[model samples]
Target chain A: MSTAHTPDRPEDGRDDDPQDRAPEHGHAPGHDQDDRAGYKTDADAGSVDERDEADAPAVDPAAENAEGGEPAARVELPEEQQGEQEIPTFDLTLQIRRYNPEVSDEVHWDEFKLTMYGTDRVLDALHKVKWEIDGSLSFRRSCAHGVCGSDAMRINGQNRLACKVLLKDLDLSKPVTVEPIKGLPCEKDLIVDMEPFFQSYREIMPFLVAGGNEPTMERYQSQEDRARFDDTTKCILCAACTSSCPVFWTDGQYFGPAAIVNAHRFIFDSRDDAGDLRLEILNDKEGVWRCRTTFNCTEACPRGIQVTKAIAEVKNAILSRSM
Target chain B: MSTPLKASISVPRSKDLEVNGVKYNRSSSRRNNFEMYAWLFMRLSGVVLLVLVFVHLWVNLVSPEGGVEAVDFAFVAGKWASPFWQVFDMLLLWLAMLHGTNGLRVIIDDYAERDRTRFWLKVFLFTTSAFVILLGTLVIFTFEPCPAGADPALLASFCAAG
Candidate 1:
């Protein structure tokens, strides 16, 4: 099942063209105010400021004791504590690559500046734009807390999940550049055809194989044996690691990091009987040898799988079997 | 672009392939330490080359009577006369060729797309490497510093002195 959480368009906010605005480093005047933050005009500004002060603790005793009761230190703690669900709002420009095959001939960038919470994720900003500011903006996201790997995109030139990257973690001084992940054919705005990636995943045969009679109880495994391949078990098939790899970018047929990692999960499993077959599959010319050990996959994996290390292990397995 | 793939729920068929009513491991003819030895040789030779190359440079250039300019026919002839220097030169020649050939082979395997292309490229590489190695070995061992009938003026100063 696909969970593409794209909102339907509202009629009124569609008229204000984001393209007409200056691409300068100022507040996104009309749109950000209209969206989530509900940033007020000059007349209503006082009430918003009053509400912020009321929500925050008037004084932090630890800050006063640690800093000799400096007034500035007391003021900073409230802002620091704002990230704890209170979400201090800040102006951010979400520079998104927009493409519609039916409408536009080529992809063009569209910037939406909005007053967003420090607690807000990149997906939240996209949701705000689609829900309140402009309805035509589209992206894919599911299990918005990063479990489902649907929202993998290049945020600031690195593969990351939209739901995983917080606005506070980003450099708000520059526009947050959100584009589709590289090494895949971008189908539309912030979405690529994942079939090619999944095709590679399928070729690896990521599952267990036991060549024995059905056990009355589950086949027992020692804690150490389970721990051996435990790191690779977190793969969500996100393609973040694969798309980030320079080798996979150059050679599409190379079984990318995710596939090898999944293969490693079974290859090292003590219960699996088909490991030799898996190793032989990976021993092809376009297999583990193609990995340059760039560590880009290790960096991009949201589930924190040690992708390069797993690839190395698979290479060792092939080496042992071949020799 | 084609349609985005739906999430996979199909059960893994890990036991599909069978032989003679029983499962069997895939057969592979290559059962040797060729790659393992090559990889080990690269690392081991790298450490040895680091010291040997630096020391050879120092003796021939920096620490000699004159840096770089002291490297003439007489300088090489004098060094090769010693058994220590001959063995040193031989090790340098062998290690460098083997290390370099293996490194290039890795690059070829990484970049070459077609099977025949990779095979031919590696064949060419191995052929050239073997030629250079043999030629270098012959030159290192059979090098003539002084000929008996050579003109005295053209011969190295050692020949005239001896």
Candidate 2:
């Protein structure tokens, strides 16, 4: 569970402001600035200046030579290019499902219309509603770009990370509907009680279980052996795939696709010793056989993990009685 | 004036039912991958079934014998007289029965939510399938076009003449 940490220092080219924390997971650098500038400028004159500054040369030797080599790059360009570089914005109506268990017994839809650019995500729309229009809007989100696995809600009746789904991908002709994921109990607006989801995940030991004498050096595993279970490693435990399952909805006790996916991660690992034990656990009546292969889990995975195929391989492993 | 409630995630539940902790009894049959093999068999047999079915259709319905009208008892008798045709038909009968049965099993598993319902449905399916396959195989191999019994009037006109 120990992650490799790179200590923060002033010389590391990272900003000191906590608000400007570096993008650690999936988002490219400078995306936060683009989104912020998009919101602030509303595609106005301010955006044009920013674009012009971005495109202008950083080290212009000819201009510097002309000004006695005294840093001509510091001089601002003429305002003509600034006029052409405009950020486009359009109005989008987000129909969000609102629920507060203490306040109400039923879920309700609240619509918020906001101006956003093409590059903005569904998470941005939720933020605009929470920060500007209604302070009472409640939801869970961290690492706003797709990594934290939080903010997995139903967007247009499909499970997706609010941060991962681009506004452009949705049909703007209709108001986009957002709700809590199906099959899990909704505790509040867009947030389900994740205890049951995590409970199933806990049943399958997600970590490596190695036995025998501790190796003096690192345990050697071939590239081909590592490649066997490579696809299952990308799981962020978002529960998007699991929640979308028809089997999980039908039988709550059934270990859903996510748990099987995690089991596949270690069950096929060449270095692990508990593969047989794990296989035996999955061999239960409610195990791999319960997967009817309707392919809802595969389609719902945001990480693009081949969930159904992994389950099939696990089924094969159980059959062959091999790891 | 009110103090802010601490924002903390809920503690995870203990794994009381993990492998070693609980007596994990399997409710379903212990046999593994009968379904797995069944799934794979469907695909592999489907390829074979495609070939066998097309050839059988061409010989009986389309080729020489023009259509459904040509497929009388005499035509069936002529085909079954040859060992090659009898064996061809036996293979076809077994493959088609097994393939169709596996497909129905998949459907039952998907649509039938109740275990007892699925079990009974599959029981009916397997029984009927076994009956058909056995009966078809028996008739294909042991069919006597002209039986020794004295029932010439009840037999096909060609069989009675022969």
Candidate 3:
């Protein structure tokens, strides 16, 4: 539950005002020209930030106090790239999490100033960073069209596939911060370890079980039957839905949304008579019961898969005691 | 200091279900295997669903015969008359329901954070899905397509053949 405090102050390296009392949580040094601290209560942000917004960074003072005592320490802290550097020429700025396990001592964010079309995607920015700025920056990518579902990452506190998110759709005034997915261990940069994710995935017996002898020839099925599970069939195994889940961050064992989306693909097959066995498997404590339905998966899904709908279908199957 | 017991128990089944050639162990989390397999089921079923779904779409809406209007009670009876359609429909029913329910399971876990709330919500979800799946399966396999001494219009084309 405890997070390591990240020492990497904001790009605008300004320290605490030193005038107002520093609360329990360390005030994050952000870009601002004021002497006031952003350490007020969450409720005070409206009143306090109202006067400080133009001159200071966009932050709620009281919001920081609630988390209490400094940023959670990440294995890699934000670097103290302090003091004013020459702001680069660009129509926009990109603050991306940079890591090269082979070279760098630790992962850190690197800001880039670029002149890009409004419709460019995070993937485009990353491509620019890798090719023009730093080839050492690593991330997974395939089927640049987004169908491969490989480029999923946390964008501005939300998990999304990089190829699918258009940069222009984001708030431009602030630096577009990006990081690897939360919960799983970081592999290189922007890629989390997926072993545990797959462990939960492969556990559900992803196969067709008719409960009878396996059919040598094609198994029989009707048209009406196929139409029912049509929607769940679109999942592309991308971890976007899974990483979007908050519970997944705390408990690595909790089966996440993408894994369940995969299971849903099979559980609905009529030719597979393994309902009893499948139900028994899914009935576990961390099974279908862990989803809190924040709609994050649905929002983050790159395939436009009706993730919530599929989850509903699975819930219906689990709640039915016949299993 | 009291350390929690790390003991585990498992049920031995005839054929172990595995995904991606990996065996599913229910012991690690000390949690039930319910959600684990539900996640797996989505992937597995999603695969088979690709085939079952395509053929189904091809037969129902894309065939040379008239579409949409050709479906009705009598149409259902006609299709059920063939064991192929019966088995196919049954598979679709089971997979879709299970897939759908597993998806809902994730929703429950994500949204229903409280213990009591999760428990009751799952109770309700399991009960309803079980009831529907049971009734549906029973109707599929044991469906009677004919009635004796009934209105000629209501009977199947071959109902009076007996």
Highest DockQ model number? 2
Off by over 4 Å in 1: A1-86, B1-45, B81-87, B101-138, B147-158
> CA lDDT of B61 in candidate 1?
80
Better of 2 and 3 by TM-score: 2
Task: Give a tens-digit lDDT track for model 3, residues A223-288.
Answer: 878766766666667787887778776445467787678778777877665555555666667666
Candidate models: Cα lDDT each: 0.69, 0.69, 0.63
Estimate the TM-score for candidate 1: 0.69
For model 1, state the Cα shift of residue A125 in Å.
1.1
- Tens digits of lDDT, candidate 1, A122-179: 8889999999998988788876655578999999999998876767667778899999
Per-candidate DockQ vs. reference = 0.10, 0.11, 0.07
DockQ pick, better of 1 and 2: 2
Candidate 1 structure lDDT: 0.69
Candidate 3 docking quality: incorrect, acceptable, medium or high: incorrect
For model 1, the docking class works out as incorrect
In candidate 3, which residue ranges exceed 4 Å CA deviation? Answer: A1-90, A102-105, A211-217, B1-162
